[model samples]
Target: MKVTILTLGSRGDVQPYIALAREMIKNGHEVVICTGATFQRFIEENKVSFYPASADLMALMESEEGRDILNGNGFSLLKIIKFSKEKIAPSYRKSMDDFYQASQGADLIIYHPKALGAVDIALYFNIPCICLPPVPIMYPITEFPNFSLSSKKSFGPVLNRLSYKLVKFSELPFIKEINDFRGKTLKSPKRKAGLYTYDINGSPIPIIYPISPFLFKKVDSWKDSVFISGFFFLDSEEETLPNEIENFLEKGKKPIVVSFSSMPLKNPSIFRKKLVQALKKTNNRAVVLTGTSGMRFNQEENILTVEKAPHRLLFKRAKGIIHHGGVGTMSEALLSGVPQIIIPFAVDQPFWANLLYKKGYSIKPLQEKNLEVFELVQALEQVGNKEYIENAQKIKNIIQSENGIHRAVKHIESVVDNIKKE
Candidate 1:
């Protein structure tokens, strides 16, 4: 079978799809990853075919409009949209062409949120396409509120349904643009924009949530079409730590690993200073992994900074982790059996952090807005608690035991087989 996975965004968004593609190739299928140009070498290095679909994510982040968003200006939605239109119009058009070409001659299409146009492309080709969301937002469920919304208060089933309605209506602005692209490019019948995400009548499409049920339990209100496979964790063949990291581990008691991969920072200096202060207050040594933002610091005997390191390898030796609560990072931390101190910025991160806290695996997450050194210290203090460590280990065991990638492969194969039978 030939499969093309359309995806974009940071490594957190793109990495899991690579895991899935690698698994498919091992199972005797051809797979290609359609993503940004920056990941071409990385994907090819992983032995997967690469299809460049957009500009590098870091380039997008470093753009003026992206800087505004990253700086926490709290711009209104309309202003943000307007900025995106002006900045991204040219690149987005080119990306659409790349996506259309990359998707040709595929047995199946799997897509993330950033590639919603893949739905129209798949429809044009009359092939099966699956919506794979790393988070729990696409489907409506009464079990809990949508991950995007900050509220956890439950009213009733009606309100639960309304939450999805709110998210659906939020797409109104982009609907015309998306439909216009379909009309011009694919020349297919006009599609209702909401159908790309939902089925107003029944189950719209196969929506797969590639996260552990242990982390987010299956909600009864979800439609039959939804499948909650465990997280598609990518365990690299090489797990060796770098010499400096090894030396750091040998030189002191286990240190907390702090990282904020891809989370835009308004002030790197303040953030760095607070992190150092928090570690000092807790009397903990630390390793900081800063990416793209070039977060730098003066060398200290107890602190080490690196551009990047494998979380799967480093988290196992660390006493605790302080991170942005990204799903990929959370999965790595959980599997490593390390307690976490989450400083969530936006978009489902706070949701994951709060779930961990509610499940007793970590303290309540500290919001990035107005974050202070004292609050970080307090969270670190909680990490030493016996209950939190025990809970972290329990969740770790659950995650470690699952064969997530194989299970996801099975799910994908089933979806493809059923489509063929039809």
Candidate 2:
């Protein structure tokens, strides 16, 4: 069978789907991944076919406004909404056209929610399509609050309902706009200008959520169409650590790994200086990743600073991890059984940090605007507590025991089989 998968956003969003696509290929299915053009080389390196969407998005994201959004300040959501309104349609349409041409006889279409046109493209072709959630954006249960929206307080039944309406209402305009574009682009009268909302109890195709079930309160009434696949992680591209780093890990004191991940800080030099001061105060060995921010620190024997290292490999040897609470980073840290200190910047990061905190795997996240050296020191100290390590290990055991990729593949095959039966 031939399967086509579509996704969008940063590297965090694209990586897992690549893992799944490779798994599908191993199972004797032809697989193609359609995402940011920046990942074309990465996808090809993994032996999966690649389709280009928008390289411009990456360039736009590296600009001043993008850096601001990454730093958790100033019109981030509004800017994203505007970009989606102005740019997403044309890029999505072109991507769909490319997919349609490439996947002439494909068996299934799996897509991210951000790829608004894929659902219609699947509908137009009368093929089965599954939604692959990159984060906890859509809630399958009515009782749970949609995590996609920004809330000032802890979510409850009242808040859940309100969040549902607010999210659905906010999406209405873009849904109509995309539908209208699809109607015109495809020249099909069957396509209508409207948003499609799915209920907890009703969905034709399965929704695959690759999150550990232990993190959140589970709903008994969650629809059968919703499947929980433990976090999908692609094997590291850099499987080996630098010899010096490996040798350093072999030394007596366990090191704390600090990384901001792909998100660049606004004033990285100031952040770096503060971090170095805090690390010196703790007297702990540290490895810092300054991604594209060009943060340079005085070379010290105890501290190692580099531009990048594979999280999958590096986190395993670390005593603890300090990072912005990206879902992908959190997942890796959890799987590594290392306690984390999350300093959330923006978007769904705070949600992940809060969830990890509630589950006892990490401390409450330090807000970037209010961050201080003392707070970083406190969080680092908290991560060394035995109870947090014990809790993190328990969660890791649960995650490792689940066969995420196999379960996801099984669901996709079942959907394709059902389509064949129809």
Candidate 3:
């Protein structure tokens, strides 16, 4: 089988899909990754075929409007919509054309939510497409409100379902633009904009959530086609830290690993200083993996700031992790069996952080907008809670034992086999 996976975003966003691609290749399937140029080397290094998309999300982040949108308010729905309408309009056609180019001979299409053109192209090819969300937000569940609009409070079954409807309704703002792409670019039917995601596709598309059931227990509310196939955790390569960082780690007692990967901050300097003061207050050292957060610092006594390093290596040796609550980071931190101190910025981050807090894996999350030194210090102090530690270890045991990639491969094959039979 030939599989084409369409995706975008930061390193964490694309890394898990690479794991999926490599697994499929090993299983004797031809796999191609269609994504931004920033990840070409990254995808090729893993020996997967690479197809570059026209627009790069990192370049989008580096754009003036992208920085303004991403920096302060932290990735709210409105912010995403606004940016998509204004900045992304010129490139929307190009992105869809690229997806079409990438899907020329694909037997199946696996897509991240960011790559919205996958469905239409899949239709053009008469192939089945799978929605592969980084978080558990693609489908509606009665157990909780939609991940995007969820708050700290549970709204019961009815309202929880309605929250999902609200997310669907939010899609209305983009319907006309998407329809234009379908009709003009793909020469496809003019799709009616529905108040939800699947409605936009006009059929029930299979969705597979690459998250552990330990984090989100299996729910009875989902349709048979929706699956929870554990996290698509990338294979780790053995890598040593820089000499200076290794020295710093060896000198200190498990320094805190602070990595706000690709999350823009309004005032990175203030955020950096706040973390420093809090770490000092808690008598901890740190290694800050500041990728695309635009934070830079002079060499400090106990903190090491670098553009990138292997989280697989660093998280295991860290005292704890302080990070933006991206699903990828959340998965890595959980795998390391360490507590997390989450600063939720936007999208499904709050939901993941809240779930972790509720499940006793992390301290309560702090608002990235209003984070103060004292509050961070408090969360740091809570990092050593006996219950959190035990629970983290328990979750680790569960995750370590999961073969998500193998299971996911089976699931995808099953879907394709069923579609072929139909």
Whose lDDT is greatest here?
A: 3
Q: List the residue pairs that clash in candidate 2.
A: none
Score residue 297 of candidate 3 by CA lDDT.
Answer: 88
Candidate 3 residue spans exceeding 4 A from truth = 73-83, 166-177, 194-196, 199-203
TM-scores for the candidates:
0.93, 0.89, 0.92
Question: Local distance difference test, per candidate?
Answer: 0.80, 0.73, 0.81
lDDT of 3 by residue, 83-196 (tens): 887767556557778888899988999998778667778888888889888776667778888866665677898888777666455436556767777888788777655422
What's the CA error at residue 321 for candidate 1, in Å? 0.4
All predictions: root-mean-square deviation over Cα?
A: 2.2, 3.0, 2.6
The number of residue pairs in model 1 that clash at the backbone is: 0
Query: What does the lDDT read for residue 306 in candidate 2?
Result: 77
lDDT of 1 by residue, 1-21 (tens): 999999877787789999999
Q: Alpha carbon lDDT of residue 12, candidate 1?
A: 79
lDDT (C-alpha) at residue 299 in model 1: 80
Q: What lDDT, from 0 to 1, does candidate 2 have? A: 0.73
lDDT per residue as tens, model 2, 1-422: 88888887777778889999989999999999877788888889888999877533555567676666555557567877776666655565566556555455777888876665676677667677887877766643445566666523447666665565543454454555555556666665543332444421234546788877555445543557577777887885546887777877887588999888777766777777778878888888998877865477787768888778888888978888988888888899988989888887677788888777876888878865657999888878887888988987888888888878888898788777876786
